[model samples]
Every structure is written in C-alpha cells, then in structure tokens.
Target: MFLGMAVFLVGCAKGGSSLNTVPVKGRVTLDGAPLPGATVTFSPKTPEGRTAAGMTNENGEFVLTTIRAGDGAVPGEYGVAITKPVATAGPVDDPRARGGALTPEQMAQIREQAKTKGGAEGGSAIPKKYTSPTTSGLTATVKRGEKNEFTFDLKSQ
Candidate 1:
C-alpha cells in the first residue's frame, strides 16, 4: 500500500503544469482612440525574467501570452514598448518592380531611389522614441493572484 501511494502521488504531481504565469491583459490607445494592429511588448526589468507580448485587436484590446495562447506572464516589473509599422504603397510605376532585365546603371538608379524613398524617419506611425524600451517612458508591475490589467495612451505629436 505504501509503494502504491508513492507511485500514485508521483504520477499526480508529474501530470500537472510546472509553469505558474499570471493573467495579464491590457488595451492600447493613440490620442484617445483605439490603436488597432499595434504590437505591445513587455520586457522584464530584471535579468532573470521572462518577457510577454501581445497585439491589439480592432478595439485596441489585447491579452498577453507568455507561454501558450493567452497563458499570460510571470509576475515582475516590465518595460513596455508599443509600435505600429506604417504600410508604404509599392512603387507601382517603377520599372524595377516588373520582371525585366535591368542594366547596371538602372540598378544603381533603383538603389538610389530606394535609399531616398522613406528618408531618415523610416515610416512608423508613432514617434520613433516610443518603439524602444529605454525611450518609451512606460513601465508596469505585474502581480500574482490579482487583476493585472493595464491601459496605455499614446500621442501622435
């Protein structure tokens, strides 16, 4: 009976999940409106911490997933960085886009055009500073056994 109980207990313990992540959810807004399709990242402030990430829906709502789908994150201090990549219209009229053989001079011109197309700013909808952890000016503290909801408001200007 003692041997049977030990085996049963070990089986029960092994069958359970080892990870203990907390529920973390949040919403993102730009200038007081829902910012859809924006990616939200939570970087651990500590060296031995795990990061969590999620993307906003049409209503700017998001559910963080650390391990599995909607599994949430491990409780800790995190630096948040939100970003939205702007879509650029393809160079429809550019001959390089077509399946045509180009001369050496044409290739050089095409490279020059690509270099000057977006300029230095690159095309993010939000300020470039907000895309990095150190410059974003956002932070959060995820706790255990409680509501870990957060809301971030961003400005265009």
Candidate 2:
C-alpha cells in the first residue's frame, strides 16, 4: 500500500516531462534606458500556438508564462507589438500646504523636467511605429525553454 501511495505522489509531480512550462523573461529598453511600465502585448504566431502575454514592471522587465494549449511559440518567426509608453502624472502637491520645502524655482524646474521627459500632460516620447523604416529591431523570436532578450531603439519622427 505504501509503495502504491509513493508511486501516486511521484506521478503527481510529473517531473522530467517536457510539458513542464518555463517562462520567457526580459527587459524592454529604449536608447539603452529602461522603459518601465510599458505595455507589451505578445500574440501567438498562430491560433494553434500557445498564447501568453504580460506587462513590463518598473524595471521594464516582463515574463510570460506558457499556456498549456498549443506548443509555446512554435520554433519559428513571431511578431512583437510594443505600445507607446503612457506617462504617469507625478504626485501633485496638496493645496492644504502639507509641504515644508520646494522653492518656486525648484517647482518650475521639476515641471520642466517632467515635460521634457515625456510631455507637459504626459505623452509617449516615441511614435507608435517607425513610419519610414520598418527595421526598427523591435521584434524577437523566442526559443523553446530559452530566455530571449530584446532591445528597441527609438528616435523622433
């Protein structure tokens, strides 16, 4: 009886099975700078392929777990679509005057930096796509059980 129970536990573990799923992890950077909080939508190469997707973290890093459906990204080509970053609004000072610092010039400088970084109202610093050159080096083909690294370089259109 004990032997049978042990065998059942081992079967449950399912070790050494190729079906054991691993994750695809990497960071998204632009001009050698981290693009934190960027939305990375990865659609499978085909309806028969495994569908997995995730969003980048504050470090512009993301991990997509393989679904049990079709083979994870068939060992072939793939298309990557990285949406333009949406800038986040900085913390606004309360009108209640809880702050005890920050001169008028300093505040102005802060606003200016934010605007230069993205926009006064916070917008994408890069265009949605390279309207001219299609070779933007934005796509990548992930290998099975392998972690792929992808870097994107952007310039003003």
Candidate 3:
C-alpha cells in the first residue's frame, strides 16, 4: 500500500505542470556557409513581446527551448539579428603581410585609430552596415507544441 501511495504521489506531481513550450531552432549562414558563433536574437514585435536570444554553436546551429511565459515570439512575426565575429592580429612574418606594404605613416594611422573609442577607436570592429540588419523584413512563425525551424541567410545591408 505504501508503494502504491508513493507511485500515485509521484505521478500527480508530474501532471501538475503544463507543457506550454514550443521549440525554436535554426541554422545561421553567410555566403552559403555555416556561420558559427553568430549571435542570433529573436525579439517580439508586440506589447506582450519578450526578447529571447541564442548564439550559434560550432555547427552554426541554435535551439531555444522552454520558451514559456511571455507570448512565444508571437505566432506571427519577429525581428532577427545575426552578428558575425571579426578576426584580428597575424604573424609578423606571415606571407599575407603584403610584403611590408603598410608604410610607417599608414601603420601609425592604424594604431592611432585602434586606440580611439566606438569602433575603430577601441580596436573594435563594426559591421559593414555599422549596425545589425533588422529581420522585420523576415518572418518566423511559432506554432504551439511544435518546433518552428528557420534558416537565416544573412547578408550585408
């Protein structure tokens, strides 16, 4: 009888929570290739909207789970942004150095710019557009209890 009661209590506890989650998954790419480490954000477009974001993994894939509370990115539209990473530094003797192409003046300018703030000032990189593109021009719908998939083909605006 004690075993039966224990089983009943466990089952009851499990049944109390609601399964209101809808899985959001997708792949990010640029120029027809996977873009790993791209930061993907899904922002709601309504008053009830809440922001949810995830970064692409090594395989350029991302998944947003347990998206409960605050409407699931609305069942209609959203704004998506993909921020790609930039590379820096290289070997002094590297062949790609342009055969000591950057003259002292140019090198000094580069260093001076790198020390500035907000983008070039702080050695920080900026997207070609100087800002992330808005996916308002794109649409991603969310369905209840089902996974909504999308493939974001990012391009420079």
* Best candidate (score: lDDT): 1
Taking all chains together, each candidate's TM-score versus the true structure is 0.68, 0.47, 0.52
lDDT of 3 at 143: 69
RMSD of 3: 15.0
- Candidate 3 segments whose C-alpha is farther than 4 A from its true place: 1-19, 65-76, 87-136
The model with the greater TM-score, 1 or 2, is: 1
Clash count for each candidate, listed in order shown: 0, 0, 3
Candidate 1 regions with alpha-carbon error over 4 angstroms: 1-17, 89-122
Could you give candidate 1's per-residue lDDT for residues 70-124 as a string of tens digits?
6677889988877665756542242222323334454343323222323124466
Q: How far off is model 1, as Cα RMSD?
A: 13.9
Weakest 10 consecutive residues of candidate 2 by summed lDDT: 94-103
Could you give the C-alpha RMSD of every candidate to the true structure, in order shown? 13.9, 14.5, 15.0
Better of 1 and 3 by TM-score: 1
Scored by CA lDDT, what does every candidate get?
0.68, 0.46, 0.48
Tens-digit per-residue lDDT, 103-125, candidate 2: 44543433243224233245554
Alpha-carbon shift of residue 147 in model 3 (angstroms): 3.2
